[model samples]
Target: MAEQPLLDVEQVSKSYGPRKALDGVSLQVGRGEFVALLGPNGAGKSTLFQLLSGLFVADGGSIRIGGLDLRTHMTAALARLGVVFQQPTLDLDLGVAANLRYHARLHGLGGRHARERIDAELARLGLAERAQEPARALSGGNRRKVELARALVHQPEVLLMDEATVGLDFASRRQLLDDVHALVASRGVGVLWASHLVDEAEGADRVVVLHLGHVLFTGTPAELVAHCGAADLAAAFLQLTAGGGRHAA
Candidate 1:
């Protein structure tokens, strides 16, 4: 039998007053797979992310992580998930290593085990040399790496990134993408990366396009390009969501 998806959102819906932020959104992220959530701003991408990562509850419908219902088994379900939000949530005054250690502690890890995991994570992120440097001293890319490492200390099976490379340079963005792909491939982790950048979605195993709070399409990058007769992801996205005028991707 095929492996079960690590993350599943079924007919999940949320609203802000009268505005429907998410209209019965459904998605799945299988083990070791990288899926991209592409949509323009205000298309409900972040709202969906919030619901999936347990930051906020969906007004309607269910969300499951590794078959555990988020509402009924929140602690158990959330334990297997890692989230990197759009903005950095690190303590700039603390060193990279210290920041990671703090995160591990917050996740219920303690004592020598936490120290070991923190050290391993910093080394894994290639920040061992800069581990002692204050986070405020690191470059934008390195800072982002620290944030990612912080999220991984618990070895979560599902990674949810919401515009993780928003302010990164082209090289940094590419590096982060490669790292994310490697994480899924080598660690058997599933990733749900939300971005408006078409280039970022190029190599995703599957792509889900959202528009006006609804999923417009869900397929491979090649399929979208082929179906829309477009040369690239950006073109395909535009063709599929052009009723409202120009879009980010």
Candidate 2:
């Protein structure tokens, strides 16, 4: 039998009173795959992220992470996911190691094991020396790296990044993307990266174009451009999201 997908979002739907934020969206990410969630500002990407992270319950449909149903087994499902939200969650007052340690403890990791994981992640991200520095003292790129390290300290099989490169400089963004790609390549971690930047999705294994709470396209970057009859990903994204004045959910 074929193995189950690492992350499966099946016909997931959500509504806010009169507005339908997501309507029957379905997608899957296999182990070691990097799937880019491409959409405009109001294309319900954030809503979907919220649902996946269990921040807000889906009004309809189901989500399964590592073959565990989110609704029926929230803890088990969540335990398999490592999430980095758009907003920075690190406590600026705390040292980088402290912040990571706190997250590890939340996931039942501590003492020697936690320290080993923390040390490894910090070194991998090139933040080893900064481990003792306050989170606020680091540059934007380093702080973002800290968040990524903390997310992986639990050694999750799936990673969810919601606009993770936002507010970063060009170099920082590129480095972050390279880091994520390395994670997928080396660790076999399935990743669902949500972003509005077409450049970020250029090399993704697959791209799911979401618009106005609906999926407009799902294929490779080349396929997306071909489907839209555009020359490149940016042009294709503009063409796909055009003619819609939809507000984000």
Candidate 3:
């Protein structure tokens, strides 16, 4: 039998009053694989992220992380997830090390071990020298890097990034992508990256195009273009989502 994927969502559904946010959404991310969740604003990406992060309960379907059911084994399933939200979650008043230290404590890492991990992540992100500086003092790109570092302090097996490059410039966005790609290659960390940017999804192992709360397509970027008979991913995406109607919240 084939090994189970590290992250799996099957027939997941969610709704807010009369509006359905997600309808039978399903996808999988294998170990070290990068799957991009491509969609427009209000395309249910945020809703799915909320469910995956345990902030919102799914009305139906199943989510498995590392073979643990998210609903039945919430703690175990959550332990395997690392998330970087689109909005920055850091306290600007706190020093970089202090922020990371708090995250470490939350994950039950403290004292020497926590320090070691913090040092290692900061060094990996080239932010070791700025450890003592307040978070507000850092550049946007570096702050995002800190957030990414914070998310991985617990050494989760899978990473969920919800439009993590939203406010970043071209260089910063590319750097963040490269950094996450390296993590996948070197640490075998599975990633489910949600974004509306076609360029961001270009290098993904697979792309799941979501429109109007449904998955319109799932395949490699090149395949999506070819399947749509378009010139490139951007054109393909435009053609696929055209007249699909405004995304449902």
Candidate 1 lDDT over 52-137, as tens digits, reads 87889999989999999999999999999999989889899998888988888879998999888888888887988998999999
Instruction: Name the better of 1 and 2 by TM-score.
Output: 2
Q: Model 2 over residues 1-249: C-alpha lDDT tens digits?
A: 167999999999999999999998988899999999999999999999999999999999999999999999999999899999999999999999999999999999989999999999999999999999999999999999999999999999999999999999999999999999999999999999999999999989999889999888888899888887898899988988896533221
**Candidate 2 colliding pairs:** 42-248
lDDT, residue 239, model 1? 85
lDDT of each: 0.89, 0.93, 0.92
- lDDT (C-alpha) at residue 44 in model 2: 99
Candidate 2 error regions (>4 Å): 244-249
Summing lDDT over every window of 10 consecutive residues in candidate 2, give the lowest-scoring window.
Answer: 240-249
* TM-score for each candidate, following the candidate numbering: 0.95, 0.96, 0.96
User: Would you list the clashing residue pairs of candidate 3?
Assistant: none
RMSD list, candidates in order: 2.7, 2.9, 2.7
Q: Write the per-residue lDDT of candidate 3 for residues 1-249, one digit (tens) a residue.
A: 167999999999999999999999988899989999999898899999999988899999999999999999998898889999988999999999999999999888999999999999999999999999999999999999999999999999989999999899999999999999999999999999999998999899999988888988888888899888899999988888885743221
